[model samples]
Target: MNFSEHFLHFIWKFRLYKTLDLFCVAGEQLRILNPGISNTDAGPDFNQAKLSIGGTYWIGDVEIHLKSSDWLVHGHQQDPAYDAVILHVVHEHDQPIYRKDGSQIPVLVLKNLYPEHLLDHYHQLVNSIHKFPCEKQIGEIEAVVVNGFLSRMMVERLEQKSALVLDKLSRLTGDWESAFYCFMAKSFGFKVNEIPFELLASALPLQVLRKHLDHPLQVEALVFGQAGFLSGSFKDEYPRKLKKEYAFLKKKYGLKPIGVGAWRFLRMRPQNFPTLRLAQFSALVLKSDRLFSKILEIEELSDLIKLLAELPVNPYWIKHYHFQKETKEVKLQLGISSVHHLIINAICLFLFSYGKYADQPQLISRAIKFLELIPPENNTIIGWYKSSGLIVESAFFSQAVLQLNKYYCAQKKCLNCGIGIKILNK
Candidate 1:
């Protein structure tokens, strides 16, 4: 039986070899005496595991290989991570290896203990046209039970996002609403521009934004300056004026400029440019004083959606970013799709970050239902999940994939994973 990356992760997570005796690549008896730190930052490579070989028991660390020959095959002798490894575990034992310090690293072949049924399932799903590793028998697994699994998945999802929340919250002087504003802006930028938006947030501090509450020009300066737009020279007097204003504000706020390319507009319609987005985004932030607090108070989805229905774009931004020769009113409203996506993502992060003990059942349930009310996400992660059979074709399937990946694959907490437990029992 050949091993895969998933199998390696499975071993680290489940310690699946505990029930059987181990063997070196030479077919000699090997034994596992310990499983070490699973979350160590810097150690003898992959999370430490201890084992004994022959009568000479050793305890340094453990590393994985597809075949025993991988020791020499991958040049493990050169990697510092493998130097302290006492035992090398592989699916097919084919060769021996030595440490950089010249100690022999014992090899243990794992196929003897791995069940054929499991291997069959793996081969069947992987070889098929279906996307998921277990797509063929997914229906055989109880849907009722799967929903329960989703409950756990949702819980996990929120915990993951909540950590990010706390990190940003810490930087926001522990102000949840302020952190939410930053979070929302970054999410709007999406993966293509996450780092840029983060830099944008840092460049334009909340204090700077708050000071400009009543003035559109101040809002423009804050957004453009933070986004690194006001750095360059524009031929127009208006942009020049904004740049001058930004310089004073930057010094007063001790702003370190971000490296965001001005929010794009070349290929986009005039409405999609950095200029318009900044104007629209600024208006929303200025109007909403306590964003997180207001969101928590919202009792219905419609009520929350109502918050995004208006255009925050300043009057001058209606037709012109710099000068107005032509008059046209472009109402800068939040796209409903964008708002729903952001709220769902935020709620997922909040619940997942806490893991199993936090017990936020109602919030997770509401979040899922809210996601169901919306359309499937149209992004890479969601697209990949859909392609892999992790989600069915439906509005809520995207959230289900998000939920499942968090609780199952990403966390490696598979014993708690509904699908993992089901497959194991099978």
Candidate 2:
């Protein structure tokens, strides 16, 4: 049976091998009382295991390798961390292994012990060239297992986003509001203009914007000016007035605008233009006393949606997509889809990150609850998973499938996935 050492771990971890009449290479009867916990750290493959050899019980670590000589190849023979290892399990016993103290480490060869079908199934799934390796067979698994795994995956997705939030928080000296402002700015960009939006946030700090929030026009001027949008000569009276207002504010605040080249507008919808997003973002700032604080206080998903959806954007944005450029009149209010995007990317991440940092499990729970309350995202990736037999009913499952696709299915890490393990064992 050809398999990686990870496959050996799976076999040993789940006890997917024959157990009757087991014996060590030293010719002593072996019985596994407990397989112990799988260790992710460097010390051992399995920790605190209990097993009987030659009518004597031993409790220590168990190290597995493709060959007995791998102990020396990996330099575990010299590393003091491996000194507590009591047994060496291998697929093939090429040579006897010894501790540094000259005592032999008992060896167990699993060459013909485990079921071969498990290895065969693993190979078939990993080696498949389809977009999703298990796409053809994933539907065969029970719904309970699939949903359970996806739920775990959704939390994993949140944890990953929380790490990013924590990193940003650290840079801002643990200020949650500032971190939220910057991240929300990035989310507003929605991939196409994310970088410029982030740069705009850095260029104009939230504190500076706070002082002028009472005057919505001045707030819009500062946001647009720092975004490098108001620098151009404009034919419109509103933009010209904003340019004049920004010229004074820019110097007063000692601010430098990001390059105009950072914004992209070649092939996007007129409504998603960076100019329009900045207008909406500025309105949002003017409407709130402290935006992140308001977000924290919001308990119900509907309230949170209402808070974002009811932004007081200036009516100028309703008729214009860019400065000096007027388009057909259109409503510039934040759409439900856009509000959901903010909730998923910005609100959920901050809630989860702050919860973790401040040791508040309730906030983390609320973050998850918010995702469950929202609808599933409509995107190419989610569409692909739905077509491949995965049931995505809400943002919770959609987020999980996104995480699973990027980290596991795309990378072919089948052995580490619960669904993959089930299919293999079946």
* lDDT tens readout by residue for model 2, 32-133: 999879999889899999999899999999999999988889999889999888889999998998888998999989889988788889889989987788
- The segments of candidate 1 whose C-alpha lies over 4 angstroms from its true place after superposition are 4-115, 125-142, 231-241, 260-262, 265-271, 320-331, 347-369, 380-396, 403-417, 420-426
Return the TM-score for each candidate structure. 0.64, 0.95
Q: Cα lDDT for residue 337, model 2?
A: 92
* Model 1, CA-based lDDT: 0.63
For model 1 the local lDDT of residue 420 reads: 60
Q: What is the lDDT of residue 314 in candidate 1?
A: 58
> Residue 274, candidate 2: how far off, in angstroms?
1.3
Alpha-carbon deviation at 213 in model 1, angstroms: 1.3
Q: Total backbone clashes of model 2?
A: 0
Worst lDDT 10-window in candidate 2 = 1-10
Per-structure clash totals for the candidates = 17, 0
